[model samples]
Target: MQEKALSPTVSTEIITLTINGTSKQLEVEVWTSLLDLLREPLDLTGTKKGCDHGQCGACTILLDGKRINSCLTLAVMHDGSELTTIEGLAQDGELHPVQQAFIDHDAFQCGYCTPGQICSTIGLINEGKAKTLDDIRDLMSGNICRCGAYTNIVKVVQEALERNHKA
Candidate 1:
């Protein structure tokens, strides 16, 4: 008797998204989160997976130049939207000013949350909402640092703002 072979399941819908200045078209499950799409499907691992929920803000990314929690959003929801991950901020192998400032200030402990922090900072900076430490804190309230490096994170944002203003 001949044995029957099982066929693999295939998805029909294709999602087109622009990530880190590049366009990607992929077939994915409808329930796939942006975090999984970025890290696993696209191989952009800089966006860390922390809480896997929106609470931690570890998977923050810029969607149409605005910061959003990728873990809470479906990949298909961002179709046709431009995304900027941690990988997108650098140019010519040089770190973005915000990224460098974080390093200079030692803004991270375990470094697991740095990507979200930096991305959220970039969004806050672009929004012109972090003019004061209090303002920065309020704006960045979404991103949590489990290592308790809030002071250093705030310092990095302030330094980056000053540097960016001067340049």
Candidate 2:
């Protein structure tokens, strides 16, 4: 006789993480990815899942203060860690300097890549690796804006970088 399934089996893991300064405990499958966990149960959709292969920076998010491809990591792997998506950049009803700079500079066209651009810009600043315009451009090369807004995007990033330095 063919072996029958013993029982309807399901495994879930409870992960505790701080998202946008809010602590969340979610029961997720071991295979659930960080991007899916954020966009699905957490309802944080700002982090887009473009080219899910990590070629595009559309799925970028801050993991423990560093930019990482959320799609490449499992949610269960980040238990007890801090995460910052595009939604987390704002504070007290005010836009983050990077976000405001984007708006002021009109750095987006279709806007599908704006969130990633903004998030990456913030992370770029935190990394402290880009000291010149060319450096910034090189560091932000991973993020692709199909709308061809690179010039404006670079301006916005530069403005935000200077603004952050003044603060």
lDDT of 2 by residue, 1-167 (tens): 86567865577899899999999888999989999999998899999989887888999999989998899999988889999999988899999878888888899998888888888998999997888999989999989999899999999878877877898
Q: Which candidate number has the best TM-score?
A: 2
Q: What tens digits encode model 1's per-residue C-alpha lDDT throughout 66-166?
A: 99999998887766889999999999999998888898888999999999999999998888767888988899999999999999999988887787788
Off by over 4 Å in 1: 1-12
How much does each candidate deviate from the true structure in C-alpha RMSD?
2.9, 2.6
TM-score of 2: 0.93
Which 10-residue window of candidate 1 scores lowest in summed lDDT? 3-12
Instruction: State how far residue 71 of model 2 sits from its true place (Å).
Output: 0.7
